[model samples]
Target: MRRLLFWLLLFALPSTQAAEELRLTNGEWAPYLGAQLPHHGIASRIVAEAFALEGIEVRWEFHPWARSLLLAERGDRHGSAVWLSSPHRKETFFVSDPILDSTYYLFHRKDRPLHWESIEDLAGLRLGATTGYDYGEPFQRAEAQQSLQIRRLGSDLLGFRQLLAGRLDAFPMDKVVGFDLLHEQFSSAERARLSFHPRPLRSDSLHLLLSRRIPQNADYMLRFNAGLARLRESGKVSQYLLEAQRPLSLGR
Candidate 1:
């Protein structure tokens, strides 16, 4: 009878508790999640709206990209949005359904065209990358072999400046971020003089990477996915993307 009662009680127990809030880690990247603005950027707004649908409050912690990633890896934080998914990271975390599609493109002087069929084509060229920015699989693997010259810049703005000044031969950055920096840091004349490689290095979906250590990750992911589904059905996601890209459309 005791064993029967125990089984009944176990079955009666709640499957999962409701998450009171979500804690996200982010860095200084803009047009995604800004360190200074809590509600800015497409990812930030999407996450905020998704959690709100579940009655979960959203909070953010802005740190250096490496430190923010470490916190997520250690399960000290819930997740980080706008992160690329990889097989290695999949072992430690659950990635949400893709929040957005992203492309890594090569930035170069407009006067000089860089023709490259693949990432390997850039071998022996000086390339600038922001510190802690993952270059996806091929570039990451190629970089490991020391086949490409990589200059790690402290910030995207600085890297664009370096590229413009001819200090670096090429730079790989997200298309949106590269465009944002070009407009924010360079004059119209200067911006007009810059261009991206004809082809993207890689195109993939970006996701909200939830740490496996969080006990409520499954619940969070479910709720987030549900909300995203509703958003997509209602065309809310498309509207948000349009708004996010508004600034880019001007004069482009």
Candidate 2:
């Protein structure tokens, strides 16, 4: 009789006691995801807001980009934010609709004059890139084939400094990010010397990808997509990104 009573009480308990918090990991990629920026930068705010719309709270872990994606892929974390899609990632994780479209550009000194019609055109130059960045399949394959000369450093800041010091021939990054960092980190005179090639290297959409380890990963993607659509309809997504793009004083 006591056992029967315990089962009845347990069954009667409300299952909706509280919503489980979703975990995500990423690192500082400014004007996109930054712990110091408002709403933790545009991408962070979008991810948080999307989950919030579904009554889910987010628990974010900021770490290096490669490590963060690895955790999510391993199911140590539920999801990862603001990442470009790749064949391996598609096979490994459930990806949602694109959160943002990013354009990759090659930044170089104005005096050097750099141009590229194809990845082949960049073969001999010492290309500065961040470690573990997904520069798309073409660039990766070329690097693997030893068709491109690649020099990797810790961060864009390091790469930019290397370029300034003539240690790197060219550095590639998102145009918006390069400009923002240029504005934030360089003096007026320094800014004048830097410019990006007119042609874009590649344009790709960034998405929030869910780990396959989570049994309900697909459902989570659906919820996030719906929330993202709603946010788009409400114009919050555009507004948020524009806010992040506000110019910062180049020199303090």
lDDT string for model 1 (92-145, tens) is 889889888888888888767788897778987889987777777888888888
Please report how far candidate 1 places residue 233 from its true position, in Å: 1.7
Query: What lDDT does each candidate get?
Result: 0.80, 0.85
Task: Score every model by TM-score.
Answer: 0.84, 0.86
Q: Which residue pairs collide, candidate 1?
A: none
Q: Candidate 2: where are CA atoms >4 Å away?
A: 1-16, 246-252
Q: With candidate 1 superimposed using the best TM-score fit, by how many Å does residue 32's alpha carbon deviate from the native?
A: 1.1
lDDT of 2 by residue, 132-241 (tens): 78787788899899899998788999999999888887898987787778877878788777777878877999999999899888888889899889888889999887
- Which regions of candidate 1 are displaced past 4 Å? 1-19, 246-252
Candidate 1 local Cα displacement, residue 170, angstroms: 1.5
Clashing pairs in 2: none
Deviation (Å) of 91 in candidate 1: 1.8
